[model samples]
Target chain A: MSTADRKARDKENLKALILQGAKKLFLEKGIEQTTIRNIADEIDYSVGTVYVYFKDKNAILHDIHTIGFQELGGSFTELFTIEDPMDRLRKMGIFYMKFAIENSEMYDLMFNVKAPMEFIEHSEKEEWNEGVGTFNALKNTVAQCMEKGHFKGHSLEPLSFMIWGVVHGMCCLEIRQRTKGVKFSKPETILMDGYHEFLKIIEKL
Target chain B: MSTADRKARDKENLKALILQGAKKLFLEKGIEQTTIRNIADEIDYSVGTVYVYFKDKNAILHDIHTIGFQELGGSFTELFTIEDPMDRLRKMGIFYMKFAIENSEMYDLMFNVKAPMEFIEHSEKEEWNEGVGTFNALKNTVAQCMEKGHFKGHSLEPLSFMIWGVVHGMCCLEIRQRTKGVKFSKPETILMDGYHEFLKIIEKL
Candidate 1:
């Protein structure tokens, strides 16, 4: 490779390394407690070097949040191959919940935390492309289900939003530890159990 | 009132005053940013006096979290008067969503934040009474609905939780500004619009 191309690739690799370190510290301590210095320490880099790639903590958070969406989108890629929209929608909810449960800290950063949104506010971007893209995937699936004569009396956006809300809410409650306080009879499996109830309802719809 | 009774009432009044001030500061600034000093300053009390009333910020947060439950419970009172279980359940969801949207910050503390739950862990209470009581109200309503020939094949707890997840998810997304990021067709009405979709589905079930 040419020297210029190698230099560009090196810059990108270092940026990814910094993000990987930040994400580790974020999950270990917490997003609020983790700092740029802590991230630098994790990756054995100077704080100055870390700042060269990212403007500030929010910038890092925004990029990590983008990475989180990319990961979610990657998991969702297989759902596109499912021919039946109804079956795809069901599996999508399951996959979405699995992702949220498995990578809760990242999921929290993507959906719940304000820093990423604040980053968008300060940056040139006018919209939350990550969030928009994910929501669109769900919306399109619901639209296809409607075209197949399911969701007989439902509007596209609100109905899609409701479906998203059901799964997201369960995941949020679980991730935020609200489920522990609620004392479910089967606490360990309540997330999937509650989801199954939703599946039953939507299958008929 | 007698001298002893008067002294007790005054003490309770001062404690309530402190909580009120702290809540105001929490709403205006934020829970993470607000300190005991800030709470004392808001109420014109010394920091030591604030500490005398509450051991720490977590205690204050727990108290405020209880108060949020009280407010939510107050809104739910009228729903019990409705004879039809289905009607009551429908109205209950509306009341829950209204409380969530109208008192977004308090709702966040009640459902999403960790401080109040942490307080519960460190305290004598082994369970979240506020959460249990509120959930029971929904559970009872759902039970009645089942007895009245609705929700024929669904289990009570998971179904109740699923319903809770739907509304809570919508409110969470809206409060966290996820709805804005997703570019809903009618951002202003999406919460209720999404809720109405759930309402319609449940009505048939």
Candidate 2:
């Protein structure tokens, strides 16, 4: 590899290390309590070095959210590679739940909490790609299903929101310990119920 | 007023005062930053007097949530007086949006954040009033539509969840300030889209 490529790789690795340490601290102490100094202490980096990498605590949170989205994106891509659109979507629903269950902290940051961090943008218009790539991924999959004629033509955005609202609402309650007295089916059951309902609606359209 | 009634009235009045003061502080400084002493100071009450009214800050939050729900329940009850099923439901959807818009802090406490305060149990497992009152309100209206032969024979709970899930998800996103670029159809359009689509499903059933 060229010298420039090697340097870029090294810088990416450092950023990843900082993110890992910061994420652990954020989950343990919460958004308000965790500080740059604490993250530096945990990672054995100097405070100045940490500052060189990130602007402030909120920057760290922004990076953490982006990284979470990246993971969730990968998970969706991995799970939805089935040749049939119907099969792909069914698997996508399971992947969505599995991703939530496995990455509770990051998942909360991505969807549950009011993420404190804001992004620097060039325009007044919405950059659907900037902070919303994760949700858009789900939307894209649903749109593809419709395009492939696996489902009838429904507004993919609202349908995506509906399927997400149910599953994400349940997941949010579970992660936050709020689903008291709720008659929960198995995780798979809950996930499939959303899938079945989506298919039912799709059939209507 | 009788002496006993006057005493009861004053007691209720004082509880409201403490909650108003505490809620103002909670919103201004957030939950963690707002202490009992700060609430007492905000209301110009002695710390001892504040304690007499509320055991702790959490107790105040619990009262806030209870009061919010009580008002919400009353709002829904008033909406029930309407005769047309679709019109009534459409109004109910508007009322839901109205409540969220008018009472931002209360909305946050009711749906997103759990109060740390103790809620007195008014409903046993066999008779959970909140869930029952809520779904029954929807069911009774839905029953009207069904009786009119608007919907054939579908279960109310699932239908209610569908409607609730859509409205709740929209409000949840709105309050979180996450719908930056997406302009909603007049609440009527979005609600009709989901509500009528739901009615269509019900009709098919």
Candidate 3:
């Protein structure tokens, strides 16, 4: 590659490295406790180098938030190969819940935390492309299911959203400790058990 | 009333007043922005006085969390008057959404915020009684529906939780700006529209 092209590539690689470190620290210690200095230390870089790449912690958080969506997309890779929309939708939720449970902190940052949204609000474009892409994928699957004569009397967008709510809510409650407050007969398996109930309902419809 | 009885009544009244002021500040500013000092100032009391009634901000948050449950219960008072378990269960979700949208900040504090949960952890009881009560109400309604031959093949607890997840997830998404991130075709009425879709699905069952 030319010198200028190599320089641009190096900058991109370093930015990815910084985000990787930030995401790890965020998962380990949570977003509130993790700092730019901590991120620099984790990546074995100077604090000045960290600031040189990103404006502030919010910038790091926003970048990591996008990375989370990418990871979620990675999980969905196997989902698209399935020919049946209903089956794909079901597996999609299973994958979504698995992602949330496995990466609880990142899921919280993506769905619940305010800093990433605030960063988007302050940015020039002010569009949540990552979120839109994720939602669209689900909406498309639901639309296909509708075409197959499943979900009669349902609007595509709202039905897709409701299904999202079911899985997301289960994960949110468990991650936020709200489930602990309620005495479930089986607290440990409530998320999966709840999901199965939803699966049963959708199969009939 | 006796002097001791009068003193008890006065203490209860002052505690309610403090919570009212604190909730106002919380709704107006936000949980992070509202402080004990802010609560005191809003109620025309001293910070020390605020502390005298509640140990810290978390304690106040716990009390307010209970009050949120009480307000939610008030909304459900009309629910039990309906005879059909399935109908009651449907309206319960509607009322729950109405409560969430109308009291968005309080809903966030009850479900998403960590402070009240932290306070419960530090307390002797170590239970989230308020959350328990709210979940029980929903569970009871679902159990009644099951008794009437609805959800014939589903387990009671998990189905109840999934149903709860459906409504709670929608509210959480709306409250946390996730709905805004996804460009829903009908952003303004997605919650209700999504819920109507759920209602359609369950009516068939």
Q: Pick the candidate with the highest lDDT.
A: 1
DockQ for all models: 0.83, 0.24, 0.81
Ranking by TM-score: 1, 3, 2
lDDT of 2 by residue, B1-205 (tens): 6999999999989878889888788778766577888888888888899878876655677677667777788888878678788678767767876787678777667666644322433223333244345646766776677677653334444444445555665566556545442333343345335334333433443
TM-score of each: 0.95, 0.73, 0.93
Off by over 4 Å in 3: A1-14, A44-51, B1-14, B45-49
lDDT of 1 by residue, B1-205 (tens): 5999999999999999999998898889878789898888888889999989998888999999999999999999888889999999989999999999889999999999988899999989999999999999999999999999999899999999999999999999998889988787799999999999998898788
Q: Which 10-residue window of candidate 2 chain B scores lowest in summed lDDT? A: B116-125
Chain A TM-score relative to the true structure, per candidate = 0.94, 0.73, 0.94
Best by TM-score: 1
Which digits, one per residue and each the tens of the lDDT, describe model 3 over residues B40-83? 99989999998889988889998888889899999999899999
Native A-B contacts reproduced, model 1: 0.78
Q: Write the per-residue lDDT of candidate 1 for residues A1-205, one digit (tens) a residue.
A: 6999999999999999999999888888889889888999899999999989998888999999999999999999999999999999999999999999999999999999888998898989999999999999999999999999999989999999999999999999988888999899899999999999999988788
lDDT head-to-head 1 vs 2, winner: 1
Candidate 3, pairs of clashing residues: none
Recovery fraction of native interface contacts for candidate 3? 0.82
Tens digits of lDDT, candidate 2, A9-32: 988888788989988887787655
lDDT (Cα, 0-100) at B142 in candidate 3:
90
Flag regions of model 2 displaced more than 4 Å: A1-15, A26-41, A45-52, A116-131, A148-159, A176-178, A181-195, B1-12, B24-38, B46-52, B82-91, B116-136, B139-159, B181-205
Stretches of candidate 1 off by over 4 Å are A1-10, B1-10
Cα deviation of B61 in candidate 1 (Å)? 1.2
